[model samples]
Target: MGVRGLTTFVKNPSYTHDGSTTLLRPHQLSNTPVVIDGKGLLQWLYFENDVDCKHGGDYREYETICTEFIEALHQRGVKPFILFDGASNPDDSKVDTLLGRCRERIQDSAKIIDGDPESPKLRPPFTTAVFLKVLESKEVGYVFCDFEADSEIVALANIMGCPVIGNDSDFFVFDLTGGYIPLSSLRWKEARQLSIPCEKYSLDHFCQAYSMRREMVPLLAILLGNDYVSRETFDDLYHRVIKRSGNIPNGPNVRIPRTIRFLQSRQNFADGAKRLLKDEARRQGKEECIEKSLQAYHIAPESRYQAYLQQDPSMVDIPDCPLPAAYVDLYRRGAFPADYINLKFRNNRKKLLPNLVEDYIRPSCHLISQRIREAIYGILLHGLHDRAVQETGREGQDIKVFIVTGMPSLPEFGSLPNLERMIDLEEERRKVLVMEVLEVDHGRVQAIRDDLKLPVATTIYWRSKLDLPVTESGHHLMRVILLGIAICYSREDLNMDDVKGNLKEAPRVMNRTAVQAFAEWQSCMYYTMHLNTLVNRPYPTPDATKLYHGTLLHRIYATTRLQRDVNPDWVETDVLRGSPAALALFRHLDGVAQNQ
Candidate 1:
């Protein structure tokens, strides 16, 4: 959703020295609405706030950050519309780019484990889920686009006449009336104190500054290349039009300024487009690529996204595969996970986010969550028997792809319920179905709190699948899970502040084994959360603060290694004090694990 070098290009002194970019303030936007890039904001918020991406993410801290951010915007009277990017459409030509990013994330995860916290904040598995949870809690307006959110984000912003808040360079090409506000230049926090300096960029101002027709912007984007057409594809065109300057260093950085100057000399987009595609024999192919990329810049007066944001019932159709109305409604509302959509379109169930777990390891970390996902697939794709959802995970230093078709052959419990009526099922029936899918013994979580049942079920499955030896790290993982469940279910009995404080320690370097174990646990929880959403959320989702604090878990694991047994004493002042219910749950899980 970005033009590779456009972000850096716009920030250059040559471009900004003109009136193209101007400082904006919140007070100046009292009634002004803005559409934010949810996907971009997700990455930006997590990384910028220094949430512990190294040892898994600090979701509790992240939740707070998102909440405060939204609240700040609200205080300034900014009507914010957040838009999230969905999976790529079938004809998406960016597969190589997507796969390249996947590889990069995997490698970066390893760097983080090797004691480098500065790696590209490899997104944690449940970041989107957590972010959406915050959005709903705050009653914010948001919708997941049909495919890439760029065009739709622009479409919506154009309709509302509001600036688009994002870091994507595509905004530079779109002729938006409200212009674009890069998150990097936003001073929302400072705006609360006073009208702090912030920047807004408009295509009009840019065109005027460069003395180029506005139509040339899209052509300029194509000439520079984008996701649809690689910059290498237009190398011949760039060489023909752009002259070299010794003052500017060579690379993608210099391509923008030189290309813009050249584009300014052109009178019309048609003439520029013709010359750009006038290479040798493959002119037709180059022309088609240019048209395809150009089509992305065309914004319709009205978009299907409007209906979606309005929560209209008519906005629930997938291209070929027809999902139930109820499921579609949930999917649109952001209640349903995007994996279902990905399954229908690409037959690809996204792999869990990469971690320190070695790709060469047998029975990859994803194996721990395979059973849960199978149940999810069985329920979602029950009638579509011929379709197989592929689990794309790491396998021996390569991205492993495998088909999940074992659910149909497994021991029969109950026929897959009709998804349309699944949400309306009796609470006990829903509980039974959820437990059966999770493969948890009904008796184990029968007496547990209603909110704890689903987590306990997943916790049981996690332990059975893990089958780890008696090790301090293994026990620490179990204790952390049990403690999280206890905290969520018994917030009143225990001192919540004390509990958070106890686990509040800086992240330390963890061995690969510890990282792998936690990664597996996270995978288990993530898939179970998806299944939980599918079955109408029988229990409350575990609070991130209570369940998974990266720093706290690392601290607890380190403490466990120094002692023979894990005790509340390992941490300070009875982290488990006045929480017999939590203790009982831990005992039950430990007992189940021991017997297994």
Candidate 2:
């Protein structure tokens, strides 16, 4: 309940290319800082990237992920600073409760009995030690904070005049005028796809649109409940405030309401939070004084260098390193910011389409479109134009075909002469990537490794965050279409029930999570399908009440209706401007044809 459904309220579909003169595309330009929340990223790598600590038989997988993330930022021409949570501030009243957890962590660290110096557990658990190793190896700079990584991320982003990357919804609260990129928003593979129509956003726009800093984004989050605050207590208080005041707080003049008048003198968040606790206590009719129990909420976005460096002079200095050569080439070549997808809603579908536009659909379509674009163009690159050979040993050349299978699917063809050159999918397994050799090759019974690094069909276990809506259905469906086209297979290749069964074991998916299942069916139908147009950005919900349905549900309805209105089964779409992937393919194909 961090920020409690604020994502729904702020990410309005209407705030778009059609209405606003500009949409935030921060990573598109040069000199923008990327502030990484060490915590947010660790969770993403473990969960979404499907990695875990297992290096040195001591769980060092996070190091690999940090390196990859840094590489991605470097490719966008942004040197990043990582801020890692150190200790909770000693002065925070919440510090007492956290002390117990910290004690347990200390005990946990002491218990690590690793003899190997390289063992990640030997350093410390949950303290950014592993990520530190990766950063040092890469000579990447970072901040080692004394508390609250979220606040640090915000503070650093503001100070650097740059964007942020991590999954936290709290970035919006920090007033990130530069912008923010949710790790979920990234295409993860291709560089050009970074500019997919939407996703990047400036919090300055959010503050302006919402009509208040109110200077209370963190206060709102405190009330909604995080690790320290009880959300249920706040919820009860909010209803009572609504019942008595006969007014919700979103309107103007919420300035120091009388219910919390004890705090009107300061009109600041700390006292407002104290008053909230007192109100809850009053509603409960407890004579027990809550003033002593009042903890100063510590979500405030104050920075290290900016806030205290004048006196402290203790800013952590990291060794500056040369940027990766491949990244330099990519930046010089230039990247495209997604051109706005200006779309007009059909009259009949007006109720269904609230903020449907080009930018909105970028998140869902960007990944799939890039993968499909690569799979199709890899044929031109390797099969038609021999580009793979020319680009051999180049970083980012390895194409992994992500699929899902619990068994050895590729080894069945191992006896074939052409297949002999292929690395065994069964060898050197990793999470989700049961068949991939990863970027670095490992010990295998067969000496033959993925030396050529040709676009191997990198299969991943089928999992999705469908209930989240904005990212679910379209992403799942697009993958199905991708695998289908790359291998020239149809519906027969997939077992719908098996697909459902695999995803059923995954956490965070919805009940009977049918999108991935359904995508299997569509992928068969869309085998040869290519977008005739740029994928229209999907809309988020207009009605905030049903936010759980998310953008996934919205796109499922809109995209299907669109397909029905135009081509019943064709997944191909048309656009005034080509998607980056499509545009790349056009140029590649065109270049080869011209040479011929």
Q: Top lDDT: which candidate number?
A: 1
Q: Which digits, one per residue and each the tens of the lDDT, describe model 1 over residues 1-596?
A: 56777777677625433554432323244457889999899778887888877777778788888888887778777878888876565564666567667677667765666676465667777777778888889888888766788888888999988889897889988988898888888766666442323577888877767777777888778767787777777676566646552234565466777777666655555674556554521554655566667788888887667776665667777566566777676676666766577665466544334443332344577778888878788777666766466666666556667777525423545676646677678867766777777777666776655666666677777866674555544555676656555555556677767776665354465656656777788888878887877777767876555567666656556555556345644432466666776666656655554444
Best by TM-score: 1
Please identify model 2 stretches exceeding 4 Å from their true place: 7-30, 52-63, 91-128, 193-198, 243-278, 281-303, 306-596
Can you give the TM-score per candidate against the true fold? 0.87, 0.38
Error of 1 at 247 (Å): 11
Q: State in Å the error of residue 377, model 2.
A: 59
Off by over 4 Å in 1: 13-28, 193-197, 240-252, 269-275, 278-289, 307-321, 345-363, 396-398, 414-427, 467-476, 487-507, 568-573, 578-596
Pairs with steric clashes in candidate 1: none
lDDT measured at residue 179 in model 2 versus the true structure, 0 to 100: 77
Q: Kindly list the per-residue Cα lDDT of model 2 for residues 424-526, writing each as its tens digit.
A: 3232222112122111122221222232111112111112212234433434343332322221212233343432332222223222223323322222112
